[model samples]
Target: MILTEEIKRIKSTEKEARKFGIQVGLVFMIITLILFISDKGNSHYFFIVGGVLIILGQLFPQLLIIPNKLWMSLGVVLGYFSSRIILFVLFYFILTPIGIAAKIFGKNFLEKKINIEKKSYWNIRNNHYNKSQTEKQF
Candidate 1:
């Protein structure tokens, strides 16, 4: 019985992640369109809508400024269907790289990027190797 409950929980979590991904993606679309169409003719409306959407998208993954690959894909789809031509082109460029990278590296590309953690200035100055106090004395 516990196993069944665990499976249900896992599935729910996965579903929620996908939902969040989709929502963020939609926001990305709005962001590009808003930025591209800012002008006097109903452009301001698009711009505002787009801005709000982008903000929501960004807030979805708080502190993660760059939306993930899946979000980018959704954004492109949303942007392409948007009423403005300029917005479509802009979003296309923003999202194409995701497909390209995925094609080149498959699903592993998004698993985790190799991030070099920051080391202390002393460590950097001394390189990664630790210095011995006795050696310094000599």
Candidate 2:
């Protein structure tokens, strides 16, 4: 029983982590799109708001696992700032390829290559239930 409960908790954590990642990616994209289309003067505001939204999206899903709201919020804030340099480096690695391609082939070509809106990131990986159901116990 204990092992089963632990497995369930682990699965839940994985689910939440996936959801949080998707949310952060979505918010980041939306904020980035708005910033890109808008004038340069409004970029500072978008950056601040985008940072806040990403942090909130990252931490909100963990609220159920974390009991103390204050500590959770504090942790989120500290995590963002403390790891920012590392995160920026990671971000560059993750996004730089796409950025370079966009510059070369143009943004529209890149968009046509990977259209997130039509692809629907959240709906793409829905094999979990089917796979679990199909698994047999010996």
Candidate that scores best on lDDT? 2
Q: Which stretches of candidate 1 lie above 4 Å from their native place?
A: 1-12, 39-138
Which candidate wins on TM-score? 2
- In order of appearance, the predictions have TM-scores of 0.21, 0.25
Among residues 3 or more apart in sequence or in different chains, the pairs in candidate 1 whose N, CA or C atoms overlap within 3 Å are: none
Clash pairs for candidate 2 = none
Q: Residue 76's C-alpha lDDT in candidate 2?
A: 58
lDDT of 2: 0.57
Residue-by-residue lDDT tens digits, candidate 1, 1-138: 543343333322333444554465566556556666663345555545555545554555432223343444555556545747776776688667777777787766454545467353232254555568557876
